[model samples]
Target: MFQHSRLTEFLLGLFAATSILAPSAAHALGGDGDKVVARVVTFGGACEKCDLSGRRMSGAQILGANFSGAALVGSDMRSVRVLGANFSGADLSRADLTDSEMIGSNFSNANLSNARLRGVQARGVAFSSAIMVKADLRDTEAQGANFSRADLSSAQFNDTSLQGAVLSRVDGRGASFRDAALQGANLSSGRFDRAIFVDASMDGAVLNGGQFDGADFRDASLHRAALFGADLSGARNLDQDQINHACSDASTRLPKGLVPRTCRGVTPHWSPKAPPAPPAPPAPPRP
Candidate 1:
């Protein structure tokens, strides 16, 4: 039963708080202002949890901000400069973070299930043991990010780049990776049951001792990818051309196909954007 004046003030404050953009490194930012906290306390921080859902705090500088264990469910923190921000055990489920920068942010043990993070630059962020089930991460950049022991079931990564990201011991059942680039990504001991990888680029990625039950690898590149002792049983649509391109070994068992001889080492897969061919000489068109 908030009055009209209260609602107007609350909306104004919320809008003012969620409009800051951050940087692209894992370091604490420099901004000592109480602008964001005051806004949060007014609108959403009722008793225990803050309901800053869809608050457009894009590109705000909130370095060293202690949000550890804070409930930021469905917050819109796009392009925020929050280096070394402590978000440990925070609940950021279903948050919208398009084009945001969350470098060096600590989301350890956070619940980010159903979060929409298209085109976010989250390099070097820590999400150890975090749960990101059904998260939408299309066209995002999460290089050097750590997701060790995270639960990522049904996560989508369309056209995303995760070069050198660590996702060891992850639960990624029914995940989709259409046109994603995962070069040098580490996914050892991950559960890929029913995961879809349509047109994914996994060059030099690590998948040691993983579970790939009901996984789809249509047009996926795995060049130099390691899958030592990985269980690829029930993996479908892994054709010979794709196998030869990505270097699979004796461990990669298809439904019923001859073990490839040319693929002893890791496979030969292409990256998302291959080096452009040398530009042809400027042609002098004669009429």
Candidate 2:
């Protein structure tokens, strides 16, 4: 009941906190130091030298706040409101931000390696070049967010919603997204080596020039998805009962229960491939 009660308090307390801080919070927007820095000290937490590592901050309104160069590694900021907050260069490794709201938050160059951001709402947030290796982002709502060139290796995001998000050139080795929704998302040239996408949706998603070596795609949906050029060496879990052969081809690694065929080769990241050859003639009566 402690976790449930904490979640309830998170909603109520954060709502009240935002109501109280909404007017004054606007003054600290866009690189204002003094106005946003006071709250870090007012809470009287263990932020000595700006180190909130492993602390628990479940319910809080931190709009337009600047946490540049701060260290919040392993902290718990679940269900909090963090709109327009700046977290540049912050160490958010292993932090828990579940069910939190982070509209227009900036996490440029932040170190969020192994962080837990499950079930969170993160609209218009920027994680450009951020390090999120092995993070857990299951069931999260991250529409219109930008994760360009981010390192998302070994991340887990099952059933997550990432509509219209940009993950261009991301390093997503060993990432898992079973049953996740990625409609209209652009993941072009991203390195998804050994990734898993069981029963996931990829409608209108661009997976051009990406790697899928040893990847798993059991029962996944790729309706109208673009796979211009990508590698599919040693892929698993692809069956004809799950996906049709007409869905994705040679450049794509087919899962189990399917046969290997000549697919379009579009190498991702490292080098581009040449165009396909002309059609070949059929054999004459098997002579």
Candidate 3:
């Protein structure tokens, strides 16, 4: 699901559109010149289809750099490290990447609309089919990230952890995910219209066929969550004893007072919630 390989040894042959290398005027930064010639450089060469639009490269390191199909509009890259960088099909619109480390970075089909990625570490990042509309990713850790079919409309992810993340078929309309952890996340067929899972944990999350129109699961936990054929029409602070404590079936589709859990494949009652409070540290370097 993460393509863009031109026989990657720093993407061999580098596919044309070169001639934007104008570094020396005491190592210039703006005007897209410097091409990261080591004021803080760690880039080991190869920049396929590079333009590096509006480059500044704050705190540049560029670990294992390749930058496949690069443009990087409005680039600043605050606190950049870019660990295992590939940036597949990169554009990075309005990029800042605040407090970036970007572990195992690929960013498959990367666009990163309105990118900031606050407190970014991005552990095991792939971001398959990534666009990341309105990306901020506040307090990001991105544990076990994949983000399959990603669009992430109005993305914020306040206090994000994303543990064991896959996020299959993600669209995430009006996404917020406040106090997010997403324990054992898979989030199959996700759309999440008007999404805002306040105090979120999503324990043992799977969320099969998720769509949750007007979603706002206040004080959200969802212990041992599954929600087979999940729809949750007009979901807002979901009640009915939190869908009878989790693991739904009978083709789960609730909204008005709820009552549909008769598929009895039960065995998911651990109720463990108190672990998501460690992500608010790394946003201090952009001076």
Superior candidate under lDDT, 2 versus 3: 3
Q: C-alpha displacement of 226 in model 2, angstroms?
A: 0.9
Ranking 1 against 2 by lDDT, winner: 1
Could you tell me the lDDT of residue 70 within candidate 1? Answer: 62
Best by lDDT: 3
Q: Rate the local accuracy (lDDT) of all candidates.
A: 0.68, 0.67, 0.74
User: Alpha-carbon error at 173 in model 2, in Å?
Assistant: 1.2
Local accuracy of candidate 3 as per-residue lDDT tens digits, 1-287: 11233223222222111124545442454543333332344443456666767666666666656677788787777878777668888898889989878777688888988888899888768888889898898999887788988899889988898877788888998899888998878888889888898889887788888898988998898776888888986788888776777888678788976886643565343233332322221221222
Candidate 2 least-lDDT 10 residues: 270-279
Residue 74, candidate 3: Cα error in Å is 6.3
Let me know the TM-score candidate 2 reaches against the reference structure.
0.69
Best by TM-score: 1
Summarize candidate 2's per-residue lDDT along 1-287 as a digit string, tens digits: 12333333443454345335544464655333322432342111111125657555665556555566678888768777676667877899989888888776788788889898998877667888999999898898877678899998999878988777888899988999888887767788998888998887776677777777777877776655666565654557655543342235556655444543333443222111221221222222221
lDDT of 1 by residue, 120-230 (tens): 877778888998999888888887778889998999878888777888999989988778888888888999999987788887788778888888888888777776667
In angstroms, give how far residue 36 of model 2 lies from its true place: 21
Candidate 3 lDDT (Cα, whole model)? 0.74
lDDT rank order: 3, 1, 2
